[model samples]
Target: MAEKKANPALMKPLTPSPELAAVVGSDPLPRPEVVSKVWDYIKKHDLQNPQNKREIIADEKLQPVFGKDRVTMFEMNKHLSRHLHS
Candidate 1:
């Protein structure tokens, strides 16, 4: 078996849009870090729906990035991609 290396593109730091910064801070961060921070914010704010763990209920700070009141966990990454740039 061969060892696999992480993708440089995925490791590269990306800047977040103003809307995203509100939740994840203004510093540039790798995609995974950004996702982690967003998840932290979501957990901290109790944004995940109790009845449906897969759904996220957006707060005011997250509305601009999410573009709606609610989004599924699977769809969050798609929404976040729009706010990140290399």
Candidate 2:
């Protein structure tokens, strides 16, 4: 057996755009941490659609990042990608 190591790419720090900063904060973070922070924001703000938990309703702070009023959870990563840079 061989020891497994975390992927360096996954550990790389990325800068967030201003819109993303509104929810996730203005700091360089790893992709996982960024996602975690976004989830925290979503939970804190109760942004998940009641009828469909898979959907997220954008609030004022998230509107610019999502560029739409609603998005599927799967689509969230795409939107977040546009707001992050290595």
Candidate 3:
């Protein structure tokens, strides 16, 4: 059998739950899409702390996923995995 490689697109997309939708919107999207949207929101909102670029300020919708008021960008990916399934 040939070796299998992970397809970036095959990853399941995460849909915003009701609570999340209140902040992000009602759109159901893939994990990558969600992440991109979150990043866009962060950038547009200037949520990143100037002293720490790695840190991301969690808005109301993202607070549940992050489990904290703030998270490092690296931690964002880690936390996002919990909200997704294979």
The TM-score leader among the candidates is 1
Task: Give the local distance difference test score of model 1.
Answer: 0.97
TM-score of each: 0.94, 0.94, 0.70
lDDT of 2 by residue, 9-43 (tens): 98899999999999988999999999999999999
- Displacement of residue 79 (Cα, Å) in model 2 is 0.5
| Candidate 3 local lDDT, 1-86, one digit each (tens) | 99997676755555666555555576667776777877888898888999998888887767887889999998888776666543
Greater lDDT among 1 and 3 belongs to 1
In terms of lDDT, the best-performing candidate is: 1
Give each prediction's root-mean-square deviation over alpha carbons: 0.9, 1.1, 4.0
Q: Candidate 3: lDDT of 77? A: 80
lDDT of each: 0.97, 0.95, 0.75
Candidate ordering by TM-score (highest first): 1, 2, 3
* Candidate 1, pairs of clashing residues: none
TM-score, candidate 3, is: 0.70
Clashing pairs in 2: none
